[model samples]
Target: MSNSSKAVVSFIVGAAVGVAVGYFLNSDKKDELVEKLKDQKNRLKEKWNKRKDQLQDELENEFA
Candidate 1:
């Protein structure tokens, strides 16, 4: 293979190996991590929505 092709193959192999190792290492904690991330995302979204509503209400009251 050409040098560029060799590099591409090396990169793909390296990525696959890295993902496999990381997956194996984190398999047990994956669910817990995912749940925590989901909960955090929900909380942030809720806070943003509430702030947006409050701002909108203020703007309406000020101009009305």
Candidate 2:
């Protein structure tokens, strides 16, 4: 209903999907898959953080 609630729900859903994908990939490739996923996760975090920071800056500027 609220913005925070929607954000929380989105985070939970994203986490669930990530875990499921990791589990399946790990089952097939074991160590290699785990390493690949770790790299992907790090990249995803960096990209997401950059985008989020940019959006926040834009919003702050707009409001200021």
Candidate 3:
């Protein structure tokens, strides 16, 4: 894409993210949103750790 096109796309994405953050900050359900985000974060961490352990075990078995 052209430079101007890239700039426009970036601006649009930034505006969309700003609107989302503004809505969440202003909404009455902010606490619920925070809880949901935290839960998602935890689940992602668990999945990451599990994958890392699996990779480590595989490497050990391959080399051992």
Best by TM-score: 3
On residues 1-64, what C-alpha lDDT tens digit does candidate 3 reach at each position?
Answer: 9999999999999999999999999999999999999999999999999999999999999999
Q: Model 3 segments beyond 4 Å from truth?
A: none
Candidate 2 lDDT, tens digit per residue, 1-64? 9999999999999999999888876686677877988999999999999999999999999999
lDDT of 1 by residue, 1-64 (tens): 8999999999999999999879966799878877888999999999999999999999999999
Per-residue lDDT of 48 in model 1: 100
CA lDDT of every candidate: 0.93, 0.93, 0.99
Clashes found in each candidate (C-alpha, N, C closer than 3 A): 0, 0, 0
Residue 28's lDDT within candidate 2 is 62
Better by lDDT, candidate 3 or 1: 3
Model 2 clashing residue pairs (backbone): none
Give the TM-score of each candidate. Answer: 0.60, 0.55, 0.79
Tell how far residue 39 is off in model 1, in angstroms. Answer: 0.2
How many pairs of residues in model 3 come into backbone collision? Answer: 0
Q: Using alpha carbons, what is the TM-score of model 3? A: 0.79
